[model samples]
Target chain A: DTAVSQTPKYLVTQMGNDKSIKCEQNLGHDTMYWYKQDSKKFLKIMFSYNNKELIINETVPNRFSPKSPDKAHLNLHINSLELGDSAVYFCASSQDTDGGTEAFFGQGTRLTVV
Target chain B: SQELEQSPQSLIVQEGKNLTINCTSSKTLYGLYWYKQKYGEGLIFLMMLQKGGEEKSHEKITAKLDEKKQQSSLHITASQPSHAGIYLCGADSSNAGKSTFGDGTTLTVKP
Candidate 1:
């Protein structure tokens, strides 16, 4: 079974089009996250949700919004996508323990805004 | 605000050779993780180190967290083409369940 899965492994859309990427995890994790990997392979955290509650919000543009319908699903919606928003988006989930946390990542959705 | 910096952005090694990739952090690391990603794929968790001076080995890959907990290294022995991939280092300073990742080091093993 795939631990973490995301829809639309590849997305190519118009510059002004709005798009959404859906993610789900079956690991029964309490925390989930959205990360963006730019062309330089810099993976930066954009948002984090713990049990459907927003916990961490990086300084991402307002056009990007994350919605967690439940603990198992977290989706990202981008409005009026710009060229700068073209990057690979990854969804990850982790369970926190006193010892440490190990994250499981989805296959990633490659978004290209032209 | 780059918190983690991985050295040797990319490397090329011959089969049966050994190589090492280093990750340096500007602040203390409460937990450090090593992950590998193939082209256009998700990250695969390799190992996690919390205690300073900790070392873990998996197959021919070994990861070590320095005594200061501010640096870590991933070493591969008897490199093979199948081992080529991007290795990323993630650090959590507060153990807040969120991690800060480095740009990643790309390794290419040639036959």
Candidate 2:
């Protein structure tokens, strides 16, 4: 079974169009995260939720909002997307909030804004 | 804020040749992770190191953490085309599971 999965493996949209990406993890983890990988392949943490509680919120713009309905799901919604929003979004999950554990990542969603 | 810097942004090596990638951190790391990412795919966890001066090997890849906990290195022996991908090092300094990653090193293995 796929431990982590994200829907819409690829997405292409125009500027000002809003879109959402869904992520789910079946590893029975207590922490989930959202990351953004730019054209340079630099991965940055955007948000993290532990047991449905927001634990880490980087300096990401308000346009990017992450919602975790429960411990197993974390979804990202972008509002009024801009051209700069083009990047690959990844979903990850770990056993807990500890940094010593390895994180399982889902196949990323490639989002392109024109 | 913690930052990880990976050296040799990209590498090209012939098949059977060995290569090493280094990751340095700005502060003491509580945990370090090594991951590989194939083109157009997600990051795959390779190994994790928590203690200083510790080394772990999987298959042909081995990772080591420095005694200062401020640096780590990943070495691959007899690399093959199937090993080509971006190698990323992540550091957790705050123990919050918020890993900070370095710009990956792109490895290209020639046949």
Candidate 3:
């Protein structure tokens, strides 16, 4: 079984459209995170949730919202997608609550806005 | 914001050669992590070093954290083509444990 799994491995959407990526982990982790990797391959944390509570939220735009339905799921929903939002989105999970925890990542979902 | 600098941007070497990649932080790090990503893929956890002077190894890959807790190095010995990928170093920042990754190190190994 996949430890962390994400739906829509590839997404192509028009600008101004709304899209959502679903993530689920069977590892029974307490923390989930959403990261975006740009064309330069720089990975940045967009949002993090611990035990269904919002934790670390970087300087991401308000258009990007992360929702944790439970301890095993974290989903990313973007309103009015932009070309700038075209990148690889990753969903990861960690068993720990704080720093210094090893994370398991999903294969990744490539988002392309036309 | 905590900035992380990594180098060299890209590397190519013959198989069986040794290579090293570095990640440094502008601010002190609470913990450091090493991840690998194949082309167009998500980051894969390799290892994590928390305390200063901490060292961890898996197979032919080994990572070391500087005593100052400001820098880290990922070294690969007897490298193979399978080791070719982008290696990223991330840190748990002071403000939060948020992970900020460097640009990346794209590695290519030839037979």
Candidate 4:
């Protein structure tokens, strides 16, 4: 069984459009995160939610929003998408352990904004 | 602190060779995680180290964390064509709540 999964593996949209990507994790994890991988392949954390509560919010723009209705689901929505927003978005979950932790990643969602 | 700095941004090796990738940090690494990713696919977690002077291995890959907690290394033995992909090192500093990630080391193993 897939532990983590993302929807709309690929998305093509125009500027000023709004779109949403859904993610779910079945690992029974307490924390979930959203990361953006740019053309340079740098994985940067955007937001994180734990137990249905927002725990970490990186230096992302206000147009980008993350929502988690339950512990197992976290979704990302972009408003007025821009070309620079074209990149792969990944969803991950982790079980915290001894001042450290490891994340389980989902197959990324490649967003292409024109 | 930039957190984790992975070296050699990319690597190319012929099959059956041994390779090593380095990850240095500004803050002491409370936790170190290694992951491998194929193009356009989700990353697969390779291993994790929380305590200093720890060593873990899976199959032909082994990872080590120094006692200083500021450095870690991933080594691949007898590399194979299937080992081609991007390798990333993630660190959890004492700050917690989030993990800092490296840009990644792209490995290209040619047969």
Candidate 5:
């Protein structure tokens, strides 16, 4: 069984379009996060939710929003997709408690904006 | 800002050789985690170090946390092509559940 899964694995959209990537974790983890990996391989956190509560919101743009309907699902929605937003997006989950924060990442969604 | 810097951005080694990668944190770390990511895939958790002077090994990979807890190292023994991937080090600076990841070290093992 997949511990953490995100879809669609690849995304190609045009500028000014809106898109959403869905993520789910079956590990029963309490914390879920969205990360963006640029071409330089820099993985930066964009948002984090714990038990459906927003915990950490990094310096991501307002056009990007993350929603967690429950503890097992966290989805990322991007509006007015720009070419600069072309990068791989990853979803991750963890236990949230101190010393239990080992994250399990999803197989990333490669977003291409044209 | 909290940052984790990994040295030797990329390395290539023979199948039987050994190599080491280092991660330095700009701020004190509450915990350090090591992960490996294959090309076009998600990251796989390797190990987590919480205390200073802690060392753990799994298979041919060993990770150590420095005495000051600001530095960490990952060493691989008898490298194999199967070990070729990107190794990343993540640090939790505040113990608040947010981890900052390094840029990652790309390793290529030749058969």
Candidate 6:
């Protein structure tokens, strides 16, 4: 079984359009995270949810919002996407909030805003 | 906040050759992880090191954490074209499962 999976593996939208990426993990983890990898290949944390509760929220734009319906699903919604929003988005899950535990990542979703 | 810096932004090695990639952190690390990412794909966890001076090996890849827990190195022996990918190092200083990742080191293995 795929441990973690993200839908719409590839997204190409025009500027000002809104889109959402869905992530689901069957690892039965409590902590989940959303990360953005820019063109430079710099992976930056965007948000984290533990058991459906927001734990970490980076300085991302207001247009970007993360909704965790439950511990197994975390979705990212971006409004009025800009060119800068073109990047690969990854969803990850861990057993707990302990850094000692290894994280399982999904096959990232590549977003392109033109 | 913590920052990870990786040296030799890119590397190219011939098949069967050996190479090493280094990751340095700004603060002491509580957990260090090594991951590999093929183009347009997610990261695959390779190994994790916690204790200072800790070392772990998987197949031909070995990773080590420095005594100070502020740096780590990943060495690959007998490289193969299949081993080519982007290697990333992530550091966790807060033990919160939130990792700070380095830019990444792109490796290209030639036959």
TM-scores for every candidate against the unseen true structure? 0.98, 0.98, 0.95, 0.97, 0.97, 0.98
Q: Is candidate 5 or candidate 6 better by DockQ?
A: 6
Query: Over the stretch B1-111, how does candidate 4's per-residue lDDT look in tens digits?
Result: 357899989999999999999999988888899999999899999999988899999999999999998899999999999999999999888757578889899999999
The residue-by-residue lDDT of candidate 3 on B1-111, one tens digit each, is: 438999899999899999999999878888898999998666788999999999999999999999999999999999999999999898887655577888899999999
lDDT of 6 by residue, B27-56 (tens): 999899999999978899999999999999
* Deviation in Å, model 4, residue B30 alpha carbon: 0.5
Top candidate on DockQ is: 2
List chain A TM-scores, every candidate, in order.
0.96, 0.98, 0.97, 0.96, 0.97, 0.98
Counted clashes in each candidate structure: 0, 0, 0, 0, 0, 0
Question: By lDDT, is 5 or 6 better?
Answer: 6
Model 3, range A9-88, lDDT digits (tens) per residue?
99999999999999999999999999998899888888889898998888888999998989999999999999999999
Over A1-114, each residue of candidate 1 has an lDDT whose tens digit, in order, gives 999999999999999999999999999998899999999999999999988999889999999999999999999999999999999999999985332689999999999999
Candidate 6, superposed: residue stretches over 4 Å from native: none
**RMSD of candidates 1 onward, in order:** 1.1, 1.0, 1.3, 1.2, 1.1, 1.0
Of the true interface contacts, each candidate retains a share of 0.72, 0.91, 0.75, 0.79, 0.68, 0.86
Candidate 3 lDDT at B109 equals: 97
DockQ comparisons of all candidates to the true complex = 0.69, 0.86, 0.71, 0.71, 0.70, 0.83
User: Could you give the DockQ of candidate 3?
Assistant: 0.71
Q: Compare candidates 2 and 5 on TM-score and give the better one.
A: 2
Put down candidate 2 lDDT per residue, B7-79, tens digits, no spaces.
Answer: 8899999999999999999799999999999988899999999999999999999999999999999999999
Residue B78 in model 1: lDDT: 100
Scored against the native two-chain complex, candidate 2 gets a DockQ of 0.86
Clashing pairs in 4: none
Q: Report the TM-score of the second chain of model 5 against its true counterpart.
A: 0.97
iRMS for all predictions? 2.0, 1.0, 1.5, 1.9, 1.6, 1.1
Candidate 2: TM-score of chain A is 0.98
